[model samples]
Target: MKKGTSPALEVIVATHKMYVMPDDSLYQPLLVGSDFFLNQQKGVTLPKNLILDNTGAHISSKNHNYSELTGLYWLWQNTVKKDTNPDSFYGLVHYRRFLSAKNKKTPLTKTELQNLINLKYEIILPKKRNYYIENLYSHYAHTLHIGPLARTREIIKEKYPNFLPEFDRLKTRRSAHMFNIFIFKKPLFEEYCEFLFGILFALESSLTKEELTRYDGFHARFFGRISELLLDVFLYTKFPDLDKRSDVLELQVLELEPVNWIEKISNFLLAKFFGKKYKKSC
Candidate 1:
């Protein structure tokens, strides 16, 4: 708990490129596709502060398909679970999206994290993103290929039947804690990884080579996007009273980059009304 010693909360910022990071010990910048980057660009130098996902028991080669999830996998396999401190908290944030404190400009600091812990918060998440016009299923089906998500539901029904109800409930909901972001105390972190990765791995095996390759570049990263929905399934199934739980906290997401709302809305409308799929990131 001492500031000069090990941090109480360690949040890794997943990034594929170099960028300015918060000047706080709590935030660690991670190079998501380090192996691929190094192999493709032999002469380029990487920042020392950015930890490579390729190191020690990692699925670094899958970064292209898994996206930032490779970083999460590396952390799960090689970092947090190995920590000596049982009470330590761990989390993942993107280089551009972070969980903001009350003022909305600052990233959640260790002091604030400690305060949450003191108040009995075992997990912290971003506020749910609402698609007022569409439920989560229709929203995803509108913007992206729904095949993988539908396949995921089948996997849940077969392998985790208890979760099937909540998974189906997603069709009726318009909001979700998305983007695969979260902070959790050690135990919950491990439990989440086990449940999440188990489903993803099964889904991965179920895909045909053709199914995986049929999508264009943006849609190929289905694993990461699909996991975003699974977070809610895991939380809601395990803790049905999640909203009332003193152990869970939801915070605002701070977008470090300016969002192009006009283009984003246009794309959403096109996808929802015109049956067009997204071709690029917004």
Candidate 2:
């Protein structure tokens, strides 16, 4: 892959606010992830590719609910530049949650990204995340309305039967790979996005807004939250002993520290104790 011709690894930094970051040697395509209507309204400026995320379900009006995955949808549904770079690996990292260097805090450089690929790593992920004293299901139930968590199970059983056992198995685990963040080879990226969105879209249609809204503002981005848990399920399905076989997660996962710790911690605690019942009005 010649650098002048096309990038080998292209990551879409999903951001929705009015901000700017100039493109550099590393391939960062700024994706404005929101519905077409809101995209026109946000007035954000990116160096390249500020995509209107409405191309899929026109769900940008509900962007508060889908969160960053909405931007990912735009990359999946639109993004012609990927066609020009057929072998380019794709990744979605937030403006806040970049894949950091092992010893330093900066976005992984072109050389680091290429080395991972050269090593035959299948994916790049943040490090193993743990929520002590809570099985995956119990923690989710305490935080979000567990109904949708349950519904996801039924959807898999009814629609994607093959995945049901792993789904069931994953529900019992205490830790997970989270954030809707990942890097994949073009082919695996395609497989992952297709499998992920297919479940989210179908599971959501079975739900009403009443059923979906758990945290008035935050949980509304329910699909993204739910998908975070499923990533572990997806991985375990592929590599049943993944945790044991590779604490490094296939040498495929590149670990990083997430940004915005204050808000992130607050949300986790609030969700844990309150679920949808955290009411200031009370």
Candidate 3:
């Protein structure tokens, strides 16, 4: 827990782009509810989700299709449609938005900018892989140019008045993006095993171009410290929920299993060092 000896577990930053099932119908409301509460209590609760990290930026729901163009909007607008297919509308609208962004020369609105910055998961465009890479690298470099944490938080809160967990997660995951939903997304812990699985997902192997260079010089240093790094993360996970005994036990089990192997190696090394010390003392 020393200041300088903190674990330097580097996250290789990359985009998590993937084609999602147009499950926008199911997820949209949940997203709304979460955002609403997050914004309503914005001044009181720390807006941890507002921080943009590897998962991407938090998209404002204002310009988002679900609220503006879908049956959900109609429902809110008091124009109920009997055959208004939620799924169909979401897919069509999403496509329209995509094409609009691609073909149009218009400047991106605040909402569009937020989605591009945060909501769009990083995925490699197989055909235009180089372009994707270049664009993402540029984004990573310039992400913080326009705003700092407080300003960024305010901007997103203005968008998703109902839910802001994704934004909250960006803050938590800025330090570590390898973690999937557990770090930033809502965690689903069924039992100890599931909890352990959540932690594992938080571990990622993203390395930016610049980070790769540092690895070359410190291969030995990095390898030597990985065990300690993992252990430290396991320990650090307890905070913000230290009283959760079940979670604490799961973490201990997770750490101890690996610690057994680490302990044996350390014991051998200590024996050798002590023998050498005694010989020198003698």
Q: Which candidate leads the pack in TM-score?
A: 1
Candidate 1 lDDT over residue span 245-274, tens digit each: 888889999999999999999999999999
lDDT of 2 by residue, 1-282 (tens): 123445456777776664454254554544444554454676644444454555544456556767788777766655523455546677787665667557655677778777776766656777767778678887777766677778889998998888888888755777777767777766667777788889988998998766766457655666777888888777778767766653233212332333456765676677677564322211
TM-score of each: 0.95, 0.78, 0.17
Error of 3 at 90 (Å): 3.3
How does model 2 score by TM-score? Answer: 0.78
* Worst 10 contiguous positions by lDDT, candidate 1: 1-10
Q: Model 3, range 1-282, lDDT digits (tens) per residue?
A: 011232111111111111121221112211222344345555553322221121122222321211212222222222112223221111111211221234344322324323432543221110111222223223222321211223333433564332234434433332321111111111111122233222222221233334324432223122112211222233234343433423221100011012354654454344344431111100
Q: In terms of TM-score, which candidate is stronger, 2 or 3?
A: 2
Native RMSD of candidate 2 (Å): 4.7
Q: Each candidate's lDDT (Cα)?
A: 0.89, 0.66, 0.24
* Candidate scoring better on lDDT of 1 and 3: 1
How would the candidate models be sorted by lDDT, starting from the highest?
1, 2, 3
Would you list the rank order by TM-score, best first? 1, 2, 3
RMSD of each: 2.3, 4.7, 23.6
